[model samples]
Target: MREVVPWQDGPDGDADGPLTPSRDGAAKDIRAFDGALGPARAEGLLSALELLRADTARGAQLDFELLRRSQQHTLDAPQPPPFRSLQAFTKGGREHYGIDPTTRAHFDACQAESTTDGGRPLPLTVRAARACLDVCFFHPFDDGNARSAFLVLVFVLAREGVELDGVSLLRRITFQADDPQDALTLARYIDVHLAETRRSAASLGSQ
Candidate 1:
């Protein structure tokens, strides 16, 4: 089984402020991780990401089924994993505290609200970041919740035609389920990566 770590900021510092490519070196880390993965597993992940990209490009909304399919591809396991029936925890002991009996119902409601633009209109990055946070805090799966959350974030951004070139900050960090500030911080992180990606693309286009 994959080792799980607490979802907390690294020693580098808090994730606030404008994240610069020079400061975070996330692009390198992402590239390194991709390179280190064996060919078969790497191809599997790429296929999964493409599936998500295609679905989002076609205007599919964020939903549990979509996530399930994404996870299925991500794991490449014999049978598709189901939503975790048992409670999950992170940070060593911080329980996800999701409603166990009605977890599926809660997930359904969350997905519905995520795709719709009701109430106060939130920016696309904020919505995408929040979706990732939800999956993190919900801890919906037994083993692959983190990967699923990342894919969900990617799908959210892809739907808007935005892709991040750097995903260093997005991974290996934990968030508090009830912390409003964490939500804002995640949104900021998304914006930082998005900005960097746009800048890189523009630079390449000019070259």
Candidate 2:
């Protein structure tokens, strides 16, 4: 994430259009998760959707506070959990995320890349995909890191004035830090979804 990948930009890859709301893919995915695997455990994500929209409107920077707020409802804790201090393991201990003094800072820097810096900007697909991967690799949350990763991906796109009508391609997907192809694959998958979303919205508009 600190080294943002220059994921190739394709025609109309950015989410500057079809801002019109259509089907809520993220919410639908969340609802499915809530109903089946998690029950109300994923309810926080529903609230996070509202938070994402509100934060996007205010142009809030993607940081730890936003992440903390995203988890408040799910954890049912009045006090939001702090940045995870100890190491985090996932995928049945197949993955281990280490932490130290600079871990949170590194995560923050990765979040900052969601916006364009002085350098050339990455495609929205790349940025969003990167955010999703960063959350996965960093494993910032004590629990529900996957949920947070999903929200971060949506938040990154929402920041760029794009909203997907369908997120089934992205929901529940995991990427490996060791695999470079996974990053590119994610960006491409996002491209596919974005194209479909634009087409879907255009069709709805014409009807």
Candidate with best lDDT: 2
Please, what are the lDDT tens digits per residue for candidate 2 over residues 1-207? Answer: 335444654233774643545877778778886657676666666876787779888989999888888777656668777889899888788878899999999899888887877477777788888888888898888887777888888888887778877777787567777767778888888888888888888888899
Model 1: per-residue lDDT, tens digit, 17-78? 22223222332443466548655555556667778878976888677778788778777877
Judged by whole-model lDDT over C-alpha atoms, candidate 2 comes out at: 0.78
Backbone clash total for model 2 is 0
RMSD (Å) per prediction: 7.5, 2.2
Model 1, residue 157: C-alpha shift (Å):
0.4
lDDT of 1: 0.65
TM-score, per-candidate, Cα-based: 0.77, 0.90
**10 residues in a row with least lDDT, candidate 1:** 1-10
Q: In candidate 2, what residue range of length 10 has the lowest lDDT sum?
A: 2-11
